[model samples]
Target: MKFTRRASANWKGTGMEGTGTVSTQSTVLNQTQYSFKTRFADGVGTNPEELIGAAHAGCFTMQFSFLLNEAGFTADNIDTEAKVNFEDGSIVSINLDLTATIPNISDEQFQTIAAAAKEKCPISRLFKTEITLTAKLA
Candidate 1:
């Protein structure tokens, strides 16, 4: 049970003025553009932190769904948002905001499963920074 993914980046010129394109194995983002402005300022291109957030959110939601099914419940909908905070060129923390709708499930049960998912998800374990989760049943 092992899997690996790959992404590559090519940059030119100085940090402030350089530009680059990032490509992933899935090609969901094929040679996507990114630059200093995109990373440090409000630019038109995607950044690493944004991509990380997307990955984290996707992973957590899927893991939560698995947990719910194992608990004999099915989730009607699960929405998760991951906020990756980068400060001083380092990742400081990640905040996961989750809202879910599951029939016949108590808030306590839902919270318990969500907390377990947050602790056991693969992406959650990859981060060394503090990971916080806020889960709500809808």
Candidate 2:
């Protein structure tokens, strides 16, 4: 399937002093505030890295669920944290920490499925940086 999504940003003034607002087509983030301080320093609001991490975490977790179902297992709980490591104005790597509770699944099976899901997830595939994952089954 082919589809599209949209988000917009507006900024005023210089890069270091300017502030911007980002909004999604769905209005979930209706002109959410973002500023230089928010991105590079401590400030209230959101940053691009956190947004990307959240998106990656959400996408990978959902893809994992789909894989578990296909493998004849269902997860009772799945939690994932995507850590984006940035350096020298680039995202160097992403680490996905995942914990899942599934019924009647072997450790080997879980590991295999998690690895496959990590590779198959759309967000994971989008990144050229190294992606590492640590998955635990509980």
lDDT of 2 by residue, 34-113 (tens): 99999988999898999999999999999999999998999999999999998999999999999999989999999999
In the predicted model 2, the residue pairs found to clash are: none
lDDT of model 1, residue 115: 97
Q: Which candidate ranks first by lDDT, i.e. highest? A: 2
TM-score of 2: 0.97
Tell me the deviation in Å of residue 65 in model 1.
Answer: 0.6
**Candidate 2 weakest lDDT stretch, 10 residues:** 38-47
Task: TM-score each candidate.
Answer: 0.97, 0.97
Error at 106, model 1, angstroms: 0.3
What TM-score does candidate 1 get on C-alpha atoms? 0.97
Tens-digit lDDT string for candidate 1 (1-138): 899989999999999999999999999999899999999889888899999999999999999999999999999999999999999889999999999889999999999999999998999999999999999999
lDDT, candidate 1, equals 0.95
Residue clash pairs of candidate 1? none
